[model samples]
Target: MYEYIKNPALIHEGPPRSATSMLSKPRVPLILVHDGGGTSFSYHLLDRINRPLYGIENAKLHDGGWWDGGVPEMAAHYVSLLGKILPEGGDILLGGWSMGGLLSLEMAHQIALAAREAKSRETGESSESSGTSTPKTPIFRVLGMIFIDSIFPLRLAELVGPLPEEPIILSGEHSRTMKLKDKVDLNMTHARMMVRFWQVPRWRWRDEAVPVPPTILMRAKEFVNRNPADDQSFVDYTRDLRLLGWDDYDEEHGHFIRDLWEVNGHHFSIFDHKYLDDVTKKVRKAADKLDPPEF
Candidate 1:
């Protein structure tokens, strides 16, 4: 369902590269999912990472439709697309910023599930018991995951309480201003709605059957202090930055390597030009851990 867009500049000494061609390279491709804005354009600002990089955006954005599903459904859609893109299957690095980060976790889980199912079918365990043919899905080995300033959904709720109720009626001037704001930034409006409506189902790494890949969590050094009077004070938020609410899972499982890097700037500003270089550097460093050491 996701169409591969061409980026001639990203092509290195080869024909104009498509998605499949990008994955066909010797190095495992790093796929970054779009943030809440439903577009991966922001990722283009990143400096060259010395690896094949692909950004996956919401197909609905191009088709003028809306994603009416939750995080799981969205992850499933991407996993299916990845299967088609690399039918032969190979290792890949998955990551994203904010909402994309949450989606990446789910995507990794789904990929592992598919691989397990595929293996079961191979030894006649699944088919013999179920009496139904298991549809073959491409198996992918996830090298690691990079989470950019992403807070777990449960933690997010504890930090910021319930969403404020929308006023039934607004003043004429205020209504006009709201409409203008939406027009000026339609993507933001859509993103806000998508996030507000969708529910994040409970997911835990320990509950999963497959082993989780090594994870690198790049947390913002500063917390956004927009609402000073809010119940959750800045101190409480900053104190939790050590793990970014992933402490429980990590403490329990200890199956994969977990590294946390604090990057300079607040959550949103981390993507700004002033701080983006540091972010890019950290990302590249985190990704490099999965690579074979140069002798």
Candidate 2:
């Protein structure tokens, strides 16, 4: 029942001047999560990927960010959202760019929890919900997870140095916009949100309690800064995730079948191109590893 929202800007059959072979293929369904910027529309690159990319931007499901409602509650709501959109028995892979990636992992955590709970409560007797009998377990589960240029571990960004404190004040070169101090303040606010997310006592890592999912992490290849430590630190931060049992990740790998093409944008540019062939090939490859592909 997971229905994908189709955004043409996200899908690329190929740029106007290019090939048609790629355009003719079937589009795969992608469940995309967006980074916080009040706009999920930014992730339109999925249109070009081999599969159809589904963008689930900030959930109006829980207005004030899930931190206030509790990550577990928010996480469960998201998992349910995935369920509502997908066709029954459909296997969907989860992935996100930046903060989106982090949440995907969290979704994995939520599923793992539900799976565990269902197992624990399995009684021979039938169960009833709202006075109606139903199956004893949750139905939705992810086939895999992919992370793109994502952030890892709380308080990790500080090690990378502060993000731009405020919006560039100059609209052009002369007009002033946001102040520098404002930018810093915003970063601080975001930091507090992270702290709130991790407020789940003993819940810092997903694998701590939940079974980790098959994970695909594609770390940034280019350096974000002149500081060599920044690059190394980012790697180190994610490396810790491996200890949770995700070591097979491809840091800079893309499909060999399709010529590697970038969407020409920020870190999450994987979707920018109209190259559905690339995504088709990659998803097929990934599907082979996890489960059989849908026709």
Candidate 3:
């Protein structure tokens, strides 16, 4: 059973923020994003791993107030919620499956920015206190990002225009079971936001002025080339990943590394018990390679 952690920050204004599960004493907290259905149910099997883990539920599960924002906005909400749960200015390890992976990437990027701002503020405060300049260093670090069978959706705006007014079908069993109209509205909002999310440019270190952390991409072997569109999409996505420096790995020098692991079964089916052992093994191996927390 998943132990849900409530966010005290939202005790009165909105529904409490929820975590799918949490570890008592994690080496470093690993937070996973919710899949397309906007629930962390799909990642329930990952609880078997003996690591500090938390799965973020979709904001829509609470209210429809944040339904219209793009990836940046969603990531910002998570960054705030995570700050409340994680140690202040501590290292974070993040991963996601499918669209959740893309969201995780954006969240990591946003977290780094927030960390820099906080560092700058602290440095200025220290300099004022002692009347001496203090060199600023990063307070929080995103160790790495794990991508599971995720392809960045970069053409959503062009594909889905003006935020669909019609209700989208909630295909997942978890979503289909929801009775609240607002919850269904949340799903529609996410679908529309996803169409807008692709508008956010890929993280290019030089162009975007954002740090690209090391990434581990686990692919579903059977799903990559299911159709011509899938084949082309994979090619295009991987091409950008390489261009954005997701193909480099050098553990000895502590450089950002991007590695890929091919797992059995299709995208959705890969999380089943039959394949979870192999999946968890690869996830742990990738996470272990990330920079260890400072003592």
Error of 1 at 192 (Å): 6.7
lDDT of 3 by residue, 1-295 (tens): 1223653122112112232233223356677887655666656675344446677877655343234566677777777777556545577788888767777877887777767677677778877796666553335578888888766465444434466554444444645465655563565466556545445434444334555688777777664356755534322344335322233322332444467778777766778888888887777677766644222
Q: Given candidate 3, what's the lDDT at residue 259?
A: 76
> What does the lDDT read for residue 61 in candidate 1?
44
Structural similarity to truth (TM-score) of each candidate: 0.72, 0.56, 0.67
Whole-model lDDT per candidate: 0.65, 0.46, 0.60
The segments of candidate 2 whose C-alpha lies over 4 angstroms from its true place after superposition are 1-29, 48-52, 60-66, 87-90, 119-138, 155-157, 160-192, 195-210, 226-295
Better of 1 and 2 by TM-score: 1
Q: Point out where model 3 deviates above 4 Å.
A: 1-26, 62-66, 130-139, 156-163, 166-189, 195-198, 201-210, 224-257, 291-295
Compared with the true structure, model 3 gives a TM-score of 0.67
Off by over 4 Å in 1: 1-25, 62-66, 125-136, 158-208, 226-239, 255-257, 293-295
**Backbone Cα, N, C clashes tallied per candidate:** 0, 27, 0
Lowest summed lDDT window (length 10), candidate 2 = 252-261
Model 1 — TM-score against the truth? 0.72
* Winning candidate number (lDDT): 1
Per-residue lDDT of model 2, residues 264-286, tens digit only: 22343444554434544554455
